[model samples]
Target: MSKICIVYHSGYGHTERLARAVERGAKSVEGTLVRTLSVDQVETHWSELDGADALIFGTPTYMGGVSAPFKAFLDSTGSRWASQAWKDKLAAGFTNSGSPSGDKFNTLVQLADVAAQHGMLWVSLGLLPRAPGPDGLELNRAGFFLGAGAQSPHGAPEVEAPPPQDLATGFALGARVARAAVRWKIAAGQPPTELATRA
Candidate 1:
């Protein structure tokens, strides 16, 4: 099975909720195992990332950029980049904010740049907007294409924010990445095992 790691930092829980939705979609893939890692705990679970087939990054947008802590985490991966440890790995990202256009797209761009520096392949959300779903919600209400974009109320609980549409977008992005990872491996004659695990 493919192993997918979701590394994130949630300043106020909003981003973490979106990360969970990403995990749900990845785990739904028949031959994939998913793990969520907080940036603060990266050292403890570093091995999981080293062995992952794909990595989905998440963070809350702050000051039109990735959170400070998450930026630190990305910087901390310099060693991995130098070692070429994650080269060619599938990479994707997600970000949360309090406004519909919170410049979270910039955060996603930063993440993609980090992945590129590691020689990783970036995966876009690949969702079409204005495609209505249940409850008349469009597939990507926030209209993000590079990655998932979610908006939570300023001080509201995440469950009551990010809206159902945004969470669904995250879920779809995760599933898309999982599928791509499997395909990439198979194309390389490295069919995944039936089971995978993480710390």
Candidate 2:
């Protein structure tokens, strides 16, 4: 089976929601194992990453960059990088912030940089934005996104959220990573369906 690891840090509940949305997308694929961990938890069993076929990153953008906690987690992977343990592994990232343009893309670039340092293959969200307005009632329709560059405006308890289209975007991105990983494995002479099964 193929294993995908999602590692992230959410200062508030917002980023965590994004992580969950990403996971929802990843879990939709069959035969694929999805594991989630926080930056703090990753330090205990860093080797857990070795079993992963791909790594999906998540973090809230802060001060024009990724949150410090997530950066700390990325820094902890230096040992793995030196050993080339994650080389050629599939990688992807997602970010959230209060402002629409909080330089979230910079965080994605940083994520790619980290993957590159580890010699991992990074995946992009090939899915396009949903058209015809938000999905459903449009609650949280603007919050969820995949492949980085995501933002969610502050909302009240009674206020609407990012909307459904954004969440679907996240879901598609997760599926894209799984599919891409399958292709990568096939290119590496591995079985394409080794880790895909219906839920």
Candidate 3:
């Protein structure tokens, strides 16, 4: 019953779809409860975030970084930082854009910085690719599996959607974060199946 909170800002509906995909993956884990919140929603009760076992951040890459709304949410986390409220919690981030190389890493790095400031343990995508052959997608490839960058044209049809592979990658990352939180709780002398390992 560990809790995984996914906080994200989706400029277009595409990112929101990705957030839901991540939520699906988190909930797939046994004994895990998943909560998905938009940045606006989290802004009102971010202190409650301190109660979650892990926080998975998501955003649509805007001009090479996070959207303005997500940045606003991050700014408000200073209060939590002042109190060290998120210390030792697990954190991960996902970013999506309309190009294959949309400076997604910058977004992830920004999220890592926030987690570090809050004293949380940050987790990378740490994904293995599902390419067809050994010479296929390298684990270090730009868009392996942990983080995703969709490649639809700026105004493509909604049905175009993110690449199935990218969506799968986001889901995997979410599950990994939740599982990591479960392990962190266990190491702290709590049962892994417990809900909300708040600091």
Candidate 4:
């Protein structure tokens, strides 16, 4: 079975809700085991993270970048980077902000950089942005290709913000990462000669 872990930091409930949506999507894939870990809980979940076939990261974009807490979590993975413990693992990320263009792409770049530093493979959202319908809801509304991007109106409560459309986008990202991880696992088990032949 493929194992996927989602690690995120949610300053408010909005990002946490997105994380749950991602979790649900990852769980939708058969033969996949999913786990969600908040930044605060990472201290005790190192083993789980190390063992995951893929790691999906999520964070709130604060002041044009990743939140301080999420940065801290990324920094804490220094040892993993040093030992290349996460090498060859699949990595994906998602972020939420208050505006449509809150410099959120910078946050995704930072997340991808962390994954690169650990020698992991990065997964794109693999979704196309949709034009807003009459109801003003659409998948990949943010038009982000690096990773999933979500927006919550300023001052809006988590219960109503991010809307259903953004949540669906996050779900698509999760499922994509899980499916990629499964394929990666299968490929890793193949004999080098056979893999080369297929290539």
Model 4, global lDDT: 0.92
Clash number for model 4? 0
lDDT of 2 by residue, 17-116 (tens): 7777778888888767888888888877566678889999988889888899998888878888889999999999888877777777778888888999
Off by over 4 Å in 2: 129-146, 155-157, 160-162, 190-199
**Model 3 Cα displacement at 192 (Å)?**
16
Candidate 4, pairs of clashing residues: none
TM-score of each: 0.91, 0.83, 0.85, 0.93
The residue ranges of model 1 lying beyond 4 angstroms of the native Cα positions read 156-159, 190-199
Off by over 4 Å in 3: 129-141, 144-146, 190-199
Which candidate gets the maximum lDDT versus the true structure?
Answer: 4
RMSD of 4: 2.6
Each candidate: what lDDT?
0.89, 0.74, 0.76, 0.92
- Please report how far candidate 1 places residue 96 from its true position, in Å: 0.6
Give the per-residue lDDT digits (tens) of candidate 3, residues 81-157: 99998898888888887777787778777888889999989887776545331234222234444354544457668
- Write the residue-wise lDDT of candidate 1 on 1-199 in tens digits: 8889999999877799899999998987888989999999998999999999999999999999999999999999988989999998999999999988888899999999999999999999898875566677777887888999898977655347678888888888899999998887777675445433331
TM-score of 2: 0.83
Q: In candidate 3, which residue pairs clash?
A: 1-31
- Model 3, C-alpha of 148: deviation from truth (Å): 3.9
TM accuracy, model 4: 0.93
Ranked by lDDT from best down, the candidates are 4, 1, 3, 2
Per TM-score, what order, best first? 4, 1, 3, 2
| Residue lDDT tens for model 4, 1-199 | 9999999999877899899989998998998999999999999999999999999999999999999999999999998999999999999999999999899999999999999999999999898787453356688988999999999989756457688899988888899898898899998887899657899
